[model samples]
Target: MKRNDCILAAAIFLFAGLLSVMFFLSGNEQGNYVTVTVDKKVYGTYPLDETQDIEILTEFGHNNLHVENGTVCMTEADCPDGYCKRQGEISTEKETIVCLPHKLVVEIQGAKPNGGRTEEQTDGQTGEDYDILVK
Candidate 1:
């Protein structure tokens, strides 16, 4: 293969990798997101986009859980281990902060699905489900 061909192939590979990362980070599933913090520091994140339940893990214990609507709350935990279940509910967009050991979690609800609605259609709507554009 010519040098030009090699460069073109490399560029394509890089572009594909970058796009995959962006899509993964974007959380295309469609729900709010949960942010896990440990000892007042951000630890990890989970997708809260209403597609499936959520699970959280920490040094102290592990828990299987789910969130519904806009509420970010905890329903169950490994009570036998004496952790998690007691953490309670956290619904809003960024309100419910959970503390499992040093693992502190915050649930951030993303805006409702846009359904391919253009900006023009969103204008003047009383009830709007729009995500804040950052950048």
Candidate 2:
């Protein structure tokens, strides 16, 4: 191949890689609300747009939930490791902050499904349904 041909190939590869990175970083869809669960049970669901402090008091312990600027995070917890406090803020669907010791799970829930499809239209279910199965 000529020198010009090699340069063109390299440029194309570089551009493709840049585009891939941008898409990967932007793939996270904005979440509309957050769900807090304790011991595998739904504790509460809070809107992301509302800024407030929530204290979760379960039999295990307490977790301080904070919502600010459309982001939810565990500001403080009584768990031994304090991992939940370090999990930081989340503002995207499927993102979660778990406190294993307290069995606390804080996860983001997207406002709507992709492609304007409702739950029934897409999966024929009005509520939660198992879709993925591991073989």
Candidate 3:
């Protein structure tokens, strides 16, 4: 290999390493609350700092969510597969525990100043409000 090739390769690797570090640091802000959704509708949003048990009883099934010490997990569930219970704890933004059979989704979210969710967050939309159509 030539000298210039080695320098270019090292520079590219350094840039990639810096970008990765920045993304890791910026994306790891701890989530403040979790939003529970049932059948595509907002069930509720619970704070992570508080210790509480949330019993979600929907027509499809039941799930018991336990929140404590800034983390939340599914303690119990009546779903046939019980996959939600095995998803472990989620305390970072955008992490989720999903129960497919019950159509339930629990996702971590960063809080607003007023301790309430934005329209888009509560409405189950993560990004901008614009819609795109392609035919």
Candidate 4:
């Protein structure tokens, strides 16, 4: 290969590496809050920093969510499959625990520093900012 060709390849590789690093750092940010949704409706949003147990009882079923040490997990559930409990803890943004039978979803999210819901969230809309939507 010519010297110029090698230099161009090296620069491209370096730029790619830097771009990957930037995306990794930004995308994997730790989540400060957990949002619970049932049947596509907002149930509640809770802070991960606080140690608490959230008991959810719906006509479909019941679930126990335990939050501690900045991580949230499904500790108990009445679902037949028990898959949600097996999903384990989540502390990073976009991670989720879903109980298919109960139609319950617990997702990690990054919230404003003041610990208040954004205007969109308060207006009965989700606060998530989607980068892409697929059919």
| Candidate with best TM-score | 3
Query: Candidate 3's residue-wise lDDT over 13-86, tens digit each?
Result: 99999999998876565348888888667788888888999999999999999999989999999999998899
Q: Pull out the clashing pairs in model 1.
A: 30-49, 31-49, 32-48, 37-104, 71-91, 72-90, 72-91, 73-89, 73-90
lDDT of candidates 1 onward, in order: 0.53, 0.74, 0.79, 0.78
Tell me the TM-score of each prediction against the true structure: 0.41, 0.60, 0.64, 0.62
Pairs that clash in candidate 3: none
Better of 1 and 2 by TM-score: 2
lDDT of 4 by residue, 1-135 (tens): 699999999999999999999998865663488888886666788988899999999988999999999899999999999998999999887788878788777877786323344533533433232212111
Order candidates by TM-score, high to low.
3, 4, 2, 1
The superposed Cα distance between candidate 3 and the true structure at residue 33, in angstroms, equals 0.9
Give the range of the ten consecutive residues with the poorest summed lDDT in model 1.
126-135
Better of 1 and 4 by lDDT: 4
Top-scoring candidate (lDDT): 3
Error of 3 at 41 (Å): 0.4
Worst 10 residues of 4 by lDDT: 126-135
**3-35 per-residue lDDT for model 2 (tens digits):** 999999999999999998888766554348777
lDDT of 2: 0.74
